[model samples]
Target: MEEQLQATPICGRHRALNALMAPFGGWDMPIQYEGIIAEHSWCRSSSALFDICHMGEFIFQGDFVADGLEDVFTFSVQTIPLGRSRYGFLLNERGGIVDDLIVFRLAEDKVMIVVNAATAPKDFAVIKERLTGGSFTDITAATGKLDLQGPLSRYVMVEVFGEEVATLPYFRFITLNILGVEAIVSRTGYTGELGYEIFIPADKVGELWDLLLEDERVKPAGLGARDVLRLEVGYSLYGSDIDEETTPLEAGLEGFVNFETTFVGKEALLRQKEQGPPRQKVAFEVNGRRSPRHFYDICSGGENVGMVTSGVFSPMVGKGIGIGFVLPELAVVGTPLTICHERITMEATVCELPFFKDGSVRG
Candidate 1:
């Protein structure tokens, strides 16, 4: 049976704007408003607003060590300073990733966990089960999130929110009063630009959205543009690029896993490390403008050696780019490969991770 998709509080507003709505993560979400290309251009040259309220948020209050939270993730949570956040993974017993999340260190004994929307329920259960003392609470329904991204995002944020928001460094955030409610303004985003992710009360999202759009430099963008922006920067999408069967090492994200600490899958990861990964993650660039979509076969020497997991026609580069898992020998840079679907085949070459090099993420 097909489950009915739920709608967010801003669903009506999105419909009024004639945005394209599609089912994603069990919710009817906006994929685009005016157009994906227009929104993508707007985000690159100016600023774009995104409704990110569907993401999950959790607050944990207890001893980082005693509550078993320190050993929950692959990284050490105690090392993160207040007002700073760190990105890491939550792994299953077999060293496979359950989900990748960001932990914001709010205080010495308090932390906020931001997770992907679709995995919210499962992530909550898994995290709570691992904890022995922390008072953990889910605040997804009570909170709303909006991301303002682009090269000009700082100017718009400084005008509406405050100059303090403009001064926030990367991976850091500050609490501010917005629409008579407390919100977290973080200088972090999925887009490869200078952006801010604002978390406000669920009801106040509309007001904030309207206020930002009032500025000439900002436009409303949807998930379609967001996807392109993230992919260009080589950031991995959860379900597409990684899953429960993919380990961090196999996904080309070994830097995020800290082996000094003991986590659930440490032993498995250690064993795999000694024996090397079976399939290695690879990034490729197509010779033409045609896009290579998901589940496409990657062939080398007339043999199916891998599968493309995420791919797109990069508007910025005017070419197709993709990421996939291939045999170690075929994962070398500049290696020639072929991406094939039902009747579509494209010539591609394995290259570096980021298809787009120039970005304003640090600026």
Candidate 2:
């Protein structure tokens, strides 16, 4: 049997609200406070707050080029301006992704890396071993993160956080006083909506949560709704869609990898680029409301072709949609496929990503 999971500081609050609790990455996190669809709709129509404290954070203070940090990720860290962040991946020698992360250039000599919870420890170890200069520290325990997402997220944030947040452009962050502690508000989120991710001191996180809940326009959402939102937008979940065994090129994330710089996985990526990828990532939409799920088989012409990595019943599209890896030839748009599982199968068609195209993500 699996060991009992630990709970967050807001576990009592979630329990008081009758939230559905489940173990995720060793934490007893709230799956849903109300219903998944209801919370998802609320986020799309109004504003929703998400407790993202389960994610991990790290701080590295050193020369970007000399400390070997510049070449650690797929993107160049030295070119990133202070108070701005860029998303990329850390890869193994074989070009397989170790972890997908966002690096915030706090200063010329300081940077912060935000990574997924499930890959946190492995990411730390891999990053540290590759460093040749500067000191690195895991600041996850000292940091807490929250995401407020939706079309109305901007208005709601300006009302609660401050007017300064209104000026933040995409991928930019500003340090502000929140709950009597310095917090960083970044115009970034997983959901393809206008959103902000607030990073505050851990001790003050609960207070910030309560204050946000006090707003009539804001409702507390959970990971269940978050999953649906991200899937609908075609954003890849770290462990589910990409893993250590998966290369970014095959995962449909080659844009994040920069070959102009020297990195650990450059040689392998160059080789893969010269020789076509073995498999390619593809997105599809179901014909009906029945949703595909992880590990579901993708079949074409009565033959198994691929495997679903992440899927959900899309609230925005009012249909089922999924992303999976399949043979390169079968990844064309309009290709008919079948999603198969134990005693169940559904008809689907290969389609473009972002099942819901009408979003305020850039606005």
Candidate 3:
């Protein structure tokens, strides 16, 4: 028998909105509200709200060094100033990425670790085993997260939350009061838009969600739209793009890793740095509107070279864009490639990332 999937506090609300539901990360999540394309467009032009309660949240309170937390990830924890967050990866002993996550420093001796939903349990276990001393606790069940994204998201947040949210820079967060309860509002998002992530008590999330949608400019977007928005910005999905067998170096994400840091996979990364990765990640664009799908073959001169990890027909780009792994020589810009499935085939060219530019993320 299959395990029962979890539901968020706003599941009833999503159903009321006639959302398309599907299983994601062991949870029954909303795949779309009105339609994927419409919602995706709303997020790029106006504002789109997303229910992000399925993701994981953890809290750690204690000595950063004595608890061995300083060396658990690729970047140092002690260096993160208050009200700021840093993105990096947790790697295995072989230098393969375990999970890409963000660390938020809440106070002098307290921090919050946010991770992908599917890997939450394993991430918690791995982190616990690494820490010699710390007050670590998984707060996923009690915590609720919602994301508001798009070019006008900042205006929406300021109107609903407060003016304080208007000035919050990217990757920064602040503790504020909402609905008579303390909450964390972070200027971070996955949609490659000017956005805010609001964290509040699980019971109060539904209320917040309802209040935010009161604005005429804000519409609810589901995971389907979220996936497209993230892909357009070249953000890698944890399980598909980078997994236990993929390293940051090969994924074109080495900038997130600090070579001077003493982390669990330092030696292996050093070795790989000297030896070079066998396969490297590449971004490509199809010649036409034909979309590439996962596991599709990537060929060069009729020779199988790689496989597509993520692909989509981008509304913003007006073409198909994909990310995949291939031989290092074939990962260069302008390189010709053929994407093939059982019968369908399309010509493509290697390209730089962020297939859809002109995002208001930094504005």
Give the CA lDDT, 0 to 100, for residue 98 in model 2.
92
Return the TM-score for candidate 2, rounded to 2 decimals: 0.98
Per-residue CA lDDT of model 2 for 258-320, tens digit only, reads: 888889989998999899899999999999999999999999989999999999889789899
Enumerate clash totals for all models, in the order shown.
Answer: 0, 0, 0
Evaluate residue 117 in candidate 3 and report its C-alpha lDDT on the 0 to 100 scale.
94
lDDT of 3 by residue, 151-237 (tens): 998888888888998889999999999898989999899989999899999999999999999999999999999999999999999
The most accurate candidate by lDDT is 3
TM-score winner between 1 and 3, please give it. 3
Model 2: lDDT equals 0.91
- Candidate 3's displacement at residue 355, Å, is 0.6
Rank the models by lDDT, top first.
3, 1, 2
Candidate 2 ranges beyond 4 A from true positions: none
Clash pairs detected, candidate 3: none
Error of 1 at 119 (Å): 0.7
Model 1 agreement with the true structure over 1-363: per-residue lDDT tens digits = 988887777888899999999988778889999999899889989999998888899999999999999999999998999999999999999999999999999999999999998899999999999999979999998888999999999999999988888678999999999889998999999989889999898899889988998999999998998998888888999999998999999999999999998798888899989999899999999999999888999998889999999898999979999999999888899999999988899999999968888788898
RMSD of model 3 against the true structure:
0.7
Name the lDDT of candidate 3. 0.95
Q: Name the weakest run of 10 consecutive residues (lDDT summed) in model 1.
A: 2-11
